[model samples]
Target: MDGTLLTPPKRSARARGAVLGALMLGAFTFNTAENLPIGLLDVVAGRLGVSVPATGLLVTGYGLTVAVASLPLTHAVRSVPRRHVLTGVFAALAVSSLAAALLSSYGPLLAARLVTALAQALFWAVMGPVAVGLFPPGVRGRVIGALSVAGSLALVAGVPGGTWLGRHGGWPLPVTVAAVLGLVSLVTVAVLLPTTRPEAEPAALGISPDRRRFALVLTAGALSATGAFAGFTYLVPFLGDVGGFRPETIGVLLVAFGLACLAGVSLAGALLDRSPHGVLTGAVAVQATGLLGLYAWGARPAAAVLFLVLTGGALGPVFMATQHAMLHCAPGRTDLAFAANSGAYNVGIAAGAALGGLILPYAGVRAAFLAGGLLAVAACAVLLPGRPRPAES
Candidate 1:
């Protein structure tokens, strides 16, 4: 036999690209499904004969489940094959979405939402590590950036898509569409993803942290996420109530914000490959500026929209940088680090939304923006130069 024949056949680049694409698409689909509830709160409340705040609990419940489930699930599945785990999670998501689509009562719907959240936490907790394993170190940031774009697209498309479906065919239509997308994702992962297990160092795969560095990064990530969510959860109301934008106009503005985020992630990926530290610092500062600008210009529709878009742009880069930092800080413990970051992000979302809710009833929607700005500034302070100790081992 020839020497070439003795060597294993090289995997085709196209095949690898397909796998990456599928993974990203799956991530996008899951996030879209998770967020669909946000746009449909009013419709769901009306249909279930519940108050709007009660309907909002669906979001809270899902987020809380994700926050609690990600780390433990990551630890439990550390030794499993990545593709198998992804396929299982996708299958779970599809099942949950179908259940939600079929259920008429609030209790069953809530259960379905919780299941979806569980699957989502599992998927996201694994995605970063899988992406890193798929590519060479040189291109890892770019690969991550590409995935971020797909996720941002989901955010941009999912809400409007869900809203349109709800309007044309009612709430169940959007949930059904989400389920169908999850099924498609399941099929793609099963067929396309590689079955081989990568040999990762034990340290890189665990939830136990390097202590000093992990704490600093986690704290920064949580605060930054809090700031972003504070403004984001209340975006529609802020645009409509304070900026005097119509509901249609707010929707259009949100699309603009999503586009800006797509651009930010793309730009930041290139920067991350060179200097993640600079990108992190600049992104945090810009995000703080954008939030404060929104608050300052709350009365001006044009200016507030401009600021909001800038804020979205800043958000993607900052998040990507923080995530990259966490992975680097822990070296061999990427899954755990990422899961911890995801938890922090979810915690921030919950905290920000709760804070926004508290202020909304008392200080009005604009106060939410101010709160977000303050949180961003605080995150920046925590992550500033010469503050946190370097990673160990």
Candidate 2:
């Protein structure tokens, strides 16, 4: 595991820190690009002279692209060095962001977004395994959690900041900033990250390699994600329409929701190694409770906010636990397994939003919460049959 021409050499503490920072920043930047359109929807639509709904497809299209491409691209890169491959991913993100910034037409902008999505496909599939490879196996949970935190910040900080830029400067300004962030991450990673060997260490492979357990992880994670985003996608409108909160208060509430997510991921990080199954079980249940609660009591602003935070809190940990389980129970190549998990997750995101959209007109936005809650509860049932065995080393 020590120095080789291809594999990671002995890493200094500082080098490892730099490497992780690069990866985390890469994650943050990619996610910001992915979600930035949500904040810039109206602005982008107006500038592009398109319908708001058409402009919103940037997010949906991006998720679908990642979902469809992750496995194939991960397979395609199987023979390549991960560090070098990841550099390409970052480079693509930069190029795609710049294209988004420059494109005058909606069709071209969508194309640019999808290009970034393709890079993200490869990025998510590789990042977890690569980060796990760098550290001692004992702290893998924390590592994954930290990485998820970087992503969650895309919701709290990155999107809002981009929104500010888009509002003040133009839609392209935030997209351009994302391009710069991607370039910075690309350079930092290229310079600092130690090269990893092509062959995985036994420690790096799944401990159990159970197809059934791995399926459960993906199924449960996807279900909960579907449910969470169902309400989450429409949450702002729900708050305004149902909860009667002012615009300024809703912004504050969003920050609280984001903080709650961080709290959940941090707690899961501490507990995941000890109880991966338990952590997942608890998170899905909390997810169900939050969504169901929202459906039942969302008319009351206090209860609505409380359940919203609860939903936010459980959301990050659910995916964290899913990735952790995938690492432990993958039936084949760990990277491929991670790729599948990432694909499944994006499928959930796209499905949840679409489902919410379908249900919103017919059943009303509150019904989305019910559908999501039921899905999370079903996820809980999925976990009951059997779970991944913890490593006994």
Candidate 3:
């Protein structure tokens, strides 16, 4: 037998759990590294003697690379063992992070960031199918939910912690730790992931697939992301100007919002398998309600906090459910479809931020939340009425 799985399901529950944990660690590390620059833009800029805007390119550029390269790279390695491919990617990410730390110049570090982005492209493409493959199909929703939780942790723990370290110790310290974390994930996955024959049917491919439903899933995903980020990108400005929150208290609020995100994904994992589309529609509705409520009531501090947390709660599930739904609804190859979804999500992030920026100059920050709320509502519209439900794969 091929080695994609190391043991029979009945015997390897613990082993499967351990491997899933390693995958979770890798997912956390990759997501953290991708967004870490945002929190440390100024710190990184000062260390490299560049402007903060220039340092911000590290993030925007990385997203561009991943969005462009995800499908091609995922296709190229279609025949490789996932265990091998993922471990290689982790090794590459580790090297790139180390390169960023060692190189002082902006040009060199930017090159390193691109390498990390390339690795991340393929990592996202495979990680989902791989995670679900470890468990029985009945639990796929829960599997995605668990993975999304690790990703959410990156926002609350990894990004914030890196920012704190950079502010105190230096930028390179967090960058180096990023490398260390990548290496740790690399070793763990290499040891635990099962070996496999290259010719074996991929565990990650869609079983009961649908192109129309898949298109609907992608549309809903991109729209929801666009809506959420439009508001999220301007959270601080909205809080400061509308909610009258102080800088110190905003951090606490953010931490609370992050915790709410954790709760969202956890609930999604519990309920997604039971009714996938229903959860998707409901999450988007909840997100829209929060944004709309924020736009209408954010002038009051207590109401602002409540709606902000409500939106935060839905944000994690909105996108998490998108990818989970994709696992069953992929139009073609699951990995390739995943690549497309990742690209769309990244595009959504860029679009939402750009749109919010444009709105801020003309309509004000409150208008941005209103715009976001409308888009999320539109996402709900995309998921319901005539949309065909996909069969569980």
Q: What TM-score would each prediction reach against the true structure? A: 0.89, 0.94, 0.94
Model 2 residue 95 distance off true place after TM-score fit, in angstroms: 1.3
Poorly placed runs, candidate 2 (over 4 Å) = 1-9, 201-204
Instruction: Estimate, for each residue in 244-300, the C-alpha lDDT of model 2 and write its tens digit.
Output: 899999999999998999899988888887888889899999999999999999999
| Predictions in order: lDDT | 0.77, 0.86, 0.85
Clashes (backbone N, CA, C under 3 Å), per candidate, total 3, 0, 0
For candidate 1, list the clashing residue pairs, or say none: 203-332, 204-332, 204-333
Question: Against the hidden true structure, what lDDT does model 1 obtain?
Answer: 0.77
**Tens-digit per-residue lDDT, 1-393, candidate 1:** 111112222456776677678778877887788788777889899888998989987888999999999999988987787778888988888888888888889999999999999998988877776765655655667777887778888778877788888877888888888788877777876886667542342124423234566677688778888888888888888888888998888878888999899899989887776776677777888888888888889779778877988899988787677667665665355777778788888898889888888888898888888999999999888777424333211
| Regions of candidate 3 where Cα sits further than 4 Å from its true position | 1-11, 197-202, 386-390
Q: Against the hidden true structure, what lDDT does model 3 obtain?
A: 0.85
**Which lDDT value does model 3 have at 44?**
85
